[model samples]
Target: MTHIQIGCNLSYTVTQTTSFLFNIAAARTLQQTIGEETLQLNPAIHFETFTLGTEGIQVYRIVAEPCELQLQYHAQVELYPDRYDTAEIIETDFQHLPYEVLPYLNPSRYCESDRLAHFATRLFGNIPHGYSRVTEICDWINANLDYQAGSSGESTSACDVLIQRVGVCRDYAHLAIALCRALCIPARYISGYALGLQPPDFHGFFEAYLGSRWYLFDATRMAPVEGFVRIGIGRDAADASFATIIGTAALTTMSVWAQ
Candidate 1:
């Protein structure tokens, strides 16, 4: 088990009536345990706290009327990651895949698996199957793309990253996931706090379904997979944004940490 402290501080200027939805709270899973947590607002505002499904993504929702909104979140958690044989693992056949896992095989807003299927076959089809092929896909992205900040925007997708060959962590994960799915492997995106991540902030990674379970993979290799604390899982970034705002809101400042 690895112990970690992670959180984010954000200040926003709400010029008009706006609603904010947040998903920054550390997730609780069988492999992860939360010891302590605190979520605060500068004006001592009231917000509704709720959990989404069984994912343990705690949501903090609030509406403000033309005011400076300051938000802070801190949590202590221990993460437990199970080990698996990456080289020996085999891919699950489509017919045997669980009904719930079927959605991940489809193309998403960020991961255009359908469009990239032909490319995936030509690029990686000759490689051996299963985990090794997936790792090769990860390595291909890391070697081809430059990890440049401010190189991408909110609308960046796997195809965009593929053409530009420059992006942050999520872009790396998105492209890798798209390639994995294009090759007929079940893959999904995950948002989390990565211990020992340089320039510490929220991180994005992907998980490939192998054999009978899902295994973690980070194309960026910015942090240890075992040290990652899962926060949200979804088809892509659209389903896992840290914050969503309706109406005009200018972000004044932001800070994040994980250790």
Candidate 2:
């Protein structure tokens, strides 16, 4: 077992904060299981209501009164009883899972001749068979893709990142997931905090399932290390955004800090 700590500092400035709505908060760890509610030690700066979304993703919604707003928040996560050997158990649990549990695995969404399959075939060409293939793919993504914060925008597609050769963790995960789903493998997008070494900060990571077990693989970090905290899981990044506001708000300045 291992113990890890994670922290996040998010800050933004709004042009006109008319009822500022935000969704920035830590997610309960998977160790706590689905549908379980637990208090976090580092609370959010503003009061927010928790909402559950598909695939165990949590949403924190906060509404603030109108004003020129500069908002900042920090979160810390301590992961305990960290057993990395859950791969076998995860595989076994899903071996006999009903189709209802994984409707996204339906091949109808990705026809046999679809681009997803083509991409997977290309990626799988050099990889040896079995779990090693998944590992190789994850490692390849981590090594090939550079971690840049604003390289890609919200509207960027998985294919776009593949061509650009640069992206954030979410882009890498999306590309991997697209290929995995095309190959009839079950994959999901994960959003959460990764504890940084210097001063501490929150980043994102992802996990994928091969055969009977779920393996945590961070395309961003590439290697299994300490301080990876999970916030939510979903089909893709669109399903795992920290906050999505409808109206336009110009972010003038932002800053983040952690201890």
Best by TM-score: 1
Question: How many backbone clashes are present in model 2?
Answer: 3
Off by over 4 Å in 1: none
Model 2 per-residue lDDT at 71? 48
Please provide, for model 1 over 69-141, each residue's C-alpha lDDT reduced to its tens digit, 9 standing for 90 to 100.
8999999998887876677898898999988888999999999999999999999999988889999999999
Worst 10 residues of 2 by lDDT: 34-43
Candidate 2 collision pairs: 91-212, 91-213, 194-203
- Which model scores highest in lDDT? 1
How many angstroms is residue 82 displaced in model 1 relative to the true structure, after the best TM-score fit? 1.1
Superposed Cα RMSD, model 1: 1.1
List TM-scores for all candidates, in order: 0.97, 0.72
The lDDT, on a scale of 0 to 1, for candidate 1 is 0.90
Q: Provide the overall lDDT of each model, using Cα atoms, as 2-decimal numbers.
A: 0.90, 0.55
